[model samples]
Target: MKISRTIHMTNSGRKHKTNKIKSIYNNMLAEFKRGEIGYSTIAILGQSCLGSIAVILLLMNDMPTMIKMVQLFLVTVFCMAFNGAVLAQLKSKITFDLLIATILLSACVIVTNLV
Candidate 1:
């Protein structure tokens, strides 16, 4: 009975943590959508520059062709999706999410290429 109680407590704790994280994520998305968490022009430019450098590094890396192609495809897709969101005037939250994804994906690619 004690073991079962401990397990139940652990499960409930996990659920609580999950709920907290989800709440935070939802609140942040709402703020972005409402333009409360603004992305300034400079921030956008900086993200773009980082993404471009990452792409350049990826292209110039000596990795296998197949890997390069896959990475390039990922980057292209993320970038295109972000651009599409902007062109279509989608919710700011969606655009912001895509922009963040592009930046994060680029950073990962850049780090992998550098290493």
Candidate 2:
């Protein structure tokens, strides 16, 4: 009696078996690093809208000037960080949208709080 052993004989068969898995993911990296896409424009737009509302509320409450000033500083810093994250992703460089967003948010917060 004789026995025969068969092996996979075609390149196409071997290639077909590996077609199930698509991408390779590295598990050692952290999420949202530099040059990372932090959030979409819609999300940032929403955040800005919320900030505007907060400023309006502060104005209605007649908050202290000192508090307003501090809030302004914090708002500026936060805006810079937020815009930097987006620009870093889009332009692949450490840029900031501070020119507009930061100033506008700070002014809004401070002006609203003062009133």
Q: Report the C-alpha lDDT of model 1 over 41-95, residue by residue, as the tens digit.
A: 4445666787788889999988889989999899878877876777687777778
Candidate 1: regions farther than 4 A off: 1-24, 36-44
| Cα-based TM-score, every candidate | 0.66, 0.41
RMSD of 1: 7.1
**Model 2 lDDT per residue over 62-112, tens place:** 557888667756774666576556656554223233323554675666566
Per-candidate local distance difference test: 0.76, 0.52
Candidate no. 2 TM-score: 0.41
Return the lDDT, model 2, position 23: 17
Worst 10 residues of 1 by lDDT: 1-10
Candidate 1: residue 82 lDDT (0-100) = 77
Off by over 4 Å in 2: 1-39, 90-115
Best by TM-score: 1
